[model samples]
Target: MKTILITGATSGIGKATAVAMAKHGHRLIICGRRTAVLDTLKEQLSSITEVFSLTFDVSCLQEVEAAINSLPEHWRTIDVLINNAGNAHGLEPLSEGNTADWDAMMDGNVKGLLYVSKMIIPGMKERTSGHIVNISSVAARQTYAFGVVYCASKKAVDAISEGMRLELTEFGIKVTNIQPGAVETDFSMVRFKGDEERARSVYAGYEALKAEDVAHAISYCVHAPAHVMISDLTIYPSAQSEPRTIYRKQ
Candidate 1:
């Protein structure tokens, strides 16, 4: 059983991955900004495997550093780090995009992943064993009219994942980037800035991917043999062909 640390464990893909890994008998270090939700998840998954939840805003470098640095000696040896804490703040044309939304995307999606990885990588190097799973998006592969910033952020993730794999090769640390298309999660709600109707409309008339589907993909990557590594993977729904093309029966 591996010791896995998952960020954004309070909901969606992160939460599903945490539960799936727990069932596989792996110890979980769940990190999120919401303490109550994290505690609740810990209670739910603790029956299957050991769970340790840390509350910190990943966008804050100081918080990321302090939280990981303060982990008890045992928990510090994280065998897997899942960078899953990211969201789309708003969907808008680049000319009309909100500055705050742009900052949130860059800070949380790009900088936050870097900060958390920076804190966790040294131990992996020392041990010469670890896996890093970065949850990017289909947006990274193609650009859409109103998804400029979100696409840019995920593109950065893709690049960083590749860079990390190259730099960590000598140390035997594996980096995997998972790009997912149109999963039915709080993502649309957040992207539409809490407009529930708008969010629902995005997933209507189609069978979108579920959080569990992505979780299962992550589990597959994690369970691979030590000598084998799944470098990069992209999962899309049957109804969706790419980031901008989806067939809706309605």
Candidate 2:
């Protein structure tokens, strides 16, 4: 069984992926900011396969380094790395956007991904066999109103995944960029800064993708033959035509 490392594993897509991968009998290193939740996840998944948890905020480089460095040497030889830790703090016009929100998005979505990759890539390079799956969003393809910064962050993910693929291909490392459309997760709640009504409204009209749907797609990519690399995948609900186009039955 391959050993995989997943960031933001406490909830949402990350948690669902951890479950999916564990079912495939792969050993897992689940990393996130919540120790309690990580511990609970580890406990739950341990029944399926080997499991470990690392608590750290990906936005902090020091924490990322320390946590990964602390892994037992065995777990360090990660066969797959899933860069799924990211955030969208607020949705507002540029003129009214919060600089702090911009910083959070850039730091976590862009730089946080880089920091974790920096730690894991060297090992993958040495082994000359590994896969990196970056979780991006449809926003990378189309920028909607009041989502400029968030979209920009996801676009950066698109660029980073391409760069990783180009540089790591010769080393036998595969990089896949997964751009998923609207999924019913805590994403909207966080984006709306805990506005329960607003968060619920995002999916009120139409069915949205679930975390398990995206996780299953990721599982498929990672389980492909060694000679095959499913490079980029974008998934949307049947009712959603594009990042901004969703059909709602009134």
Candidate 3:
């Protein structure tokens, strides 16, 4: 069983992926900002397999470095690193966008990912074996009105994934970029700034992808045969065709 480290493990896809990996009988290192939540999750997963949880804000480079460095020697050789901690704050037209929202998105989605990866990648390079799963979004593929900044952040993720694959392939490292569309999670709630009605309406009319669906996809990528690399995967719900085109019932 592989030793997998997943960030943003307190909720949504990250939390789901942690459970999925545990079921695969793999060792797990879960990271998130919420200490109590992380402890609770660690307790839950301990029943299944070996589990370690790190509490740190990925956006803080120092925190990211310190947390990963604090891992036990055995857990440091992470076979899989899932960069799943990211956010989409305040959907609004570019001209009307909140600068604070823009900063939060860029810092958390782009730099935070880089920070965590920077800490863990060296060991993988030395071992010449690893898989990195980056959780991008369908927004990376298509630009929707009022969500330009958020889309841009994910676009950076796509680019970063490609770059890592190109550079790390020779070391036998696999980098997979997962772009999931309209997953029913706290995403819309966060994006809508805690407006329950707005967040609820985002998924009201049709079947949206569940967090587990994306976790399942992640599991598929990491569990592939030794010679197989599921490089890029984009998942959409049956009722949705793309980022901007979703069929809503009357």
- Please report the candidate that would top lDDT against the real structure: 2
Q: What is the C-alpha lDDT profile of model 1 across 114-198, one tens digit per residue? A: 9999998999999999999999999999988898999999999999999999999789999999999999999998888789999
Model 2 ranges off by over 4 Å = none
Cα-based TM-score, every candidate? 0.99, 0.99, 0.99
Prediction 2 TM-score vs. true: 0.99
Instruction: Identify the runs in model 1 with alpha carbons over 4 angstroms from their true place.
Output: none
RMSD of each candidate relative to the true structure: 0.7, 0.6, 0.7
The CA lDDT of each predicted structure is 0.94, 0.97, 0.95
Q: What TM-score does structure 1 among the candidates reach?
A: 0.99
Candidate 3 lDDT by residue in tens digits, 1-250:
8999999999999999999999989999999999999999999999999999899999999998899889988888899999999999997788898999999999999999999999988989999999999999999999899999999999999999999999999999999999999999999889888999999998989999999999999999999999999989999999999898989999
Counted clashes in each candidate structure = 0, 0, 0
